[model samples]
Target: MRIKYSIPIVFFVALVIIEKENNIISRVSDKLALKQTPQTLVQPSRPASARPKANVSVTSQGKRSSDFMLMKRRLEDYSDYRPAAAAAAAVTSRRKDILLLATTRTGSSFVGEFFNQQGNNMFYLFEPLWHVEKMLTLDTGGTNATAAAKAYRDVLQKLFLCDFSLLESFIDPLPVDHVTASLFRRGSSSSLCGEAVCSPFVKGVFERYHCGNRRCGPLNLTLASETCREKEHRAIKSVRVRQLETLRPLAEDPRLDLKFIQLVRDPRAVLASRMVAFAAKYKNWKQWAADGDVHVDDDEVKKLRSNCNNIRMSAEMGLRQPAWLRGRYMLVRYEDVARFPMRKASQMYKFTGVPFTPQVKAWILKSTQASKEAGGIYSTQKNSTEQVEKWRFKLPFKIVQVVQKVCGPTLKLFGYKFVTSEEMLTDKSISLIEDIL
Candidate 1:
């Protein structure tokens, strides 16, 4: 009986030890499983304050790593970035400079009025180069063409930038502290004569200031420069620049968004008008016309040839759309503008990206519709449609023949029909201007 009882006690003790070992193994397995499980799948049973901070530490480290990576990317991108082109684009998008290029007697002054009358936002300079040309001619006797061109370009670049200091250097009897009454054609630029540059002599009268009238004092170029800077757009009408290619530097300048509008007209009409407008200078031309004998070797004939050649070459260069001139060049015929003033003005304004204000429209209507021209030889007002053909009557057949002989290429290029006789020349029914398109 004692042995049996001892055996049962041993078996029960063994069973109890086995059950305790199984509980310990199960607890170990649960701890291992919790350690291996994803944080999202695990549910904590401990009090919030008693829990381990491992997950919180991991989240803070991960956030710091992510922010560091983002900062490093931004720094690398900035290191490779360039702002030159972006800055240039910003400058061009805001401001525009226009060079209205044409030869004398091409109705350039009239066309210049288009921009000059663009309300107060526009700063227009009419023939500022006239001063440069005159001073250089007087000083050098007009012998140094290359030097003159350089000086002209330099002054123009400065003037476009509203830097009158260089231009003031060219003015005769140099401006005293940038005050000059000697600036050539100062009255022509309405901006120069406006109240900003020149205070009114008689207040509240609304009389436009005239440089010749001497009512307004000497032009304060410092004030002029200030006014120029205030304007949103600047336009310069010049008859001095002979070649379009010479202006490439101005176009390429990052500071200036430059565009060129070349105004051309019938050479025959140009000669006829020049003869009447400049009697003393064109006396030889008038003599040749009267005598019906023109020496092709004469200086006058050579001048005509040179002018035509320059026009043709420049037009060809502009038409080819050279890389530098791309979208920056326009060829406008004076006849076209005269025939359709409003339409042409709108096209020009559109090209320069300026508003074609009601003031311009009203001015065009009044200027083009006048029964007769109101001003002197420099007058813009005219019955423009009639003016287109007026040269046909004023120019003699002999002179016309001479112009045709010397300026054939220019005439054909610009769509001016050659007149075979006086009848054809004078006949209003015969259209001399062919449609350019």
Candidate 2:
């Protein structure tokens, strides 16, 4: 039935049909009253009523029992973690060594703004210890925990806890085994400074080890009553032996302050990056395996391995930190930092005793933009998978398959997976490596 219609008539008919179809579809949909699929549930909008309250019921000075875990997680949500102004009200009167450890792909760059904002009041250092080992590792392997401990004890008096707080411990949190197991945490060394923090004896310990002004006078008791009265050059002789080993000397000072913020990220996205750079760019797994020279044409591999190793080592260090240190620490994840960087920056601003004002928040926004524009090979939106998982299409199937096989175990630990290819899922060679590139 061929029927000819004028252009205007055809256009009117199409419009009428669309409007009718839409009306019909709406009626049908309303009548059916179909519920959304269970798997497609929307995340509840975080309204005011839905937010948790973090007000400590007790007076600021009193001991009120509350689970830190609950508070920490809720705090990450940002509504409960408002400036409280306690952070800005806190005053700083001493020099300290602040440690901010990052487990790559986390927003440590955003955290960098906290120290950067302090201007000249603080002598800020980022990943100094990490840098020392990284440069030495692939070449000399010259450094170890003992050496790090010694430097921390003798040189730096005030320790700052700027990265991941306490981590999962194997046994007693203070034991070496605990530290070893948590190779991804940071700043867990309060066991060495409890008495110094709680009692006046800390000054005595500091005097015995940290007398920068030897010209002032001898620190030893020349008059009588101490164990080392016979020691010569009393000032130099008073230096504590333990200080030579690790951070023992700095622990005794009146203001041996420990401040830190921990940044975490979902390991899945972190591991997925390997697929794009290491496996994809090189074209296949067999080629990457054959060229293991990190110093050669594999800068991305070097960076990935370095960050992974750093995360592992820092986690080890974090489990051993004491409760006192843990109290001043924060546990922030990468997801939270990206979704609401202002919230995380405000937390850091508060923790550092600086006012996190509107101006500061604006600056933080600028800093975040700068971070995105000036990142390395693994650049993406800080949290969401849309930018990170682009390798699904950018990469060839064979290479992704091989990476899934070679580093799959480690990837699982971080929570990523290799799924059946959309186009080639039924192929038997999906997970197998091709002999040729």
Candidate 3:
């Protein structure tokens, strides 16, 4: 075969290959693997001015690809780092809220405004859900529990929104979501309630509560979750605030923990104030039932009498109050509240997570003193001797005896002494208390 190879045959083969390359020149070049003399390798063209800036630099520490992807996903799902920043903003801005609790005519009006002044972070809610709970209980009582709940919640929403104009008719509606859709709904300020710190989102919840915006606010509280839960439930259900169980719902709210300050007054003084307030509001005793619409059952009448006697008795026993009330709820005597309103209010601040600032003390003195100076609201009128026991003197002896008889035991239980800065004699008050107990 080697001897037989011909130059003409080789020329024919080369000519065939050249013809194939001509058919597809681009692909044919890639296919060729030969290294020949004059083969060109062109350099990439660029502007000479291109250079890395001195200020800009890049550093690299290689992490495993899989680990990085996992971390990126985690960061997306739950990035809690931002909450701290948000809370810092809320605290600095002095935008936040606190729960208020007081029965009717217990100086709620002034008290509400008073708290608003001292608390840089505190927001005022003037009877949010005011009497709506009682009203719903009236309509839905033992009937349709769901309807009652809905009505109660509607009222609560209206209260939060401060839409009192439509409130009268709004509470009677059913299907809350429907009401939500039709009405200018203001969302709840639930989330910011118990959070250890405040945030813009939480602040928004408070801000939107007044005008109209339907949304659930974010809350980041350090309290038990139950407190917020129950508070929302009660707000929806329209439970009366006076009921002891009301505290259960409020305290248990995952959002709120109870730092209760149970403010109490001498029942005698309270009764006197009541009588005076009643007289001011009404014309005479007959109006108590007729115009004022005050009603008394056999049990309530008996209980009222019992309350007075027990109080009187307790006052005689000792000045040191019972441990039951003191520990369970900080006992703030009305007398103490009146005497050093600022100092006592500061005590409340320490308890209720409200900051006890000097400004708070100043605020209490200013607000409370103004009312006292007015000398109209439950005034203890001054006498020539600077001590007017006119109430003690003018109040019928029979009424005193009756009050002593009923509330005397409770008085000792409360740690009060029944006397007028006089002689210490037989403790009839104690004996009376013992009889009742």
Candidate 4:
């Protein structure tokens, strides 16, 4: 009698367990089927407006559970998917940044000013890395090109990000004197903070720039990220950056649309111009010093050769640029642009996708007019054919010969030939014989 009772109890318990298992499986299957089915999978019996929406929920131990809670959690935790939408938006709406990579005293400011004056569409930065040059003394002489390039690129990256912290730190407390003033003021364009009106957040930085007292401040300025993002173009002119390879990382970044306008000037003219400026700024070439000794070295000759090397390095780097940067990296001659402002300005504007409006044309004409000064360290003459050809008269024969000997190959590479006599060639010629050459 006892064994018979035990067998019946065991069978009853097993039957109840199986019933619960079947119920659970049925509920799970129904939930999955509903999820996998489209709206057309079933016809509504009632009018569409009156039909009840499908809902799936399960009750276990007095708690309701969602069929896709695990999936929802996984989706929420996966951060990588978020950037896809952001990146797509960035690709469509991001502004293009143009870099005017040039040597010192090459009239880069004049070019930069052209872009800046294009209304709200453009933001221009002038020599943001002159601070870097100051940091790297002449003794260092950019011996480690890679490190120098990296530092220059880093500064540029910061500038593009609209972070003026690095730039502000480099600002000297010195007043905007005749020599150091124009860099702080870029024609009629908006200030670094935008229109020169600074938001409370960036006010301190702008104040530190001493732009208010210096007359470098513009009437309008903003620290709004949207304002920067909304601009169609941003341009930076840097004389400190010598090699284009330094900017490779930035050019390759999908986050940025980086283009280089490698501006070249006549090396002879550059040498002569630099000499005049150096004499005026530094005062008294009578007491020049370099390399820890008071050796009598020609400042113009040293500067020309240095500028030539920089030009060559940049050209070599431009040639090696990845296939992605063909049209983006441009080589514009100052002579060409200065000679025909309307045409060259139009070409440059088109390249950067900025419309060459009537206002822009007028600015170009007025800025390059014979009576107006190009300002900054630029010559006082108009940006005319005369300005391009003026080097012939301004530079002495001996200085011209020295510059040609040093920079002739680069000049020829860029389609500039020496028309002067060969007899003037000297033993002091600075030849282009670097590894890249």
Query: Candidate 1 lDDT (Cα, whole model)?
Result: 0.77
For model 4, how does the per-residue alpha-carbon lDDT over 1-437 read when each residue is reduced to its tens digit?
99989999999999999999999999999998786453222232235355322222223211112212322232233242234334434565568788888776666766776776677777777666766656555673543556667777877887776655455445454323211222343332354545434423433234333443234332222242345556777888877776666577777777677777788777766665766677764332223322222222656445555567667556644543345554456666677777677877776665555556787777778778765345545543365655665556555555455556766546655555564653432222422211110
Candidate 3, after superposition: displacement of residue 384 in Å? Answer: 19
Candidate 3 achieves a global lDDT of 0.37
Which residue pairs clash within candidate 1? none
| lDDT digits (tens) for residues 238-313 of candidate 3 | 1123322223333333333333344444454445445566666324322443343443444444656534433222
Better of 1 and 3 by TM-score: 1
TM-score attained by model 3: 0.43
lDDT of 1 by residue, 234-326 (tens): 999998887777787998897888878899999999999899998998888888888888787898888888788778667756654456766
Candidates ranked, most accurate by lDDT first: 1, 4, 2, 3
Which ranges of candidate 3 are over 4 A from the true structure?
A: 1-113, 133-240, 280-300, 303-328, 371-375, 378-394, 419-437
Output the lDDT of residue 295, model 3: 39
- What TM-score would you give candidate 2 relative to the actual structure? 0.41
As for model 2, its CA RMSD to the true structure in angstroms is 24.5
Error in Å for residue 259 of model 4: 1.0
C-alpha TM-scores of all predictions: 0.76, 0.41, 0.43, 0.62
Name the best candidate (by TM-score): 1
Better of 3 and 4 by lDDT: 4
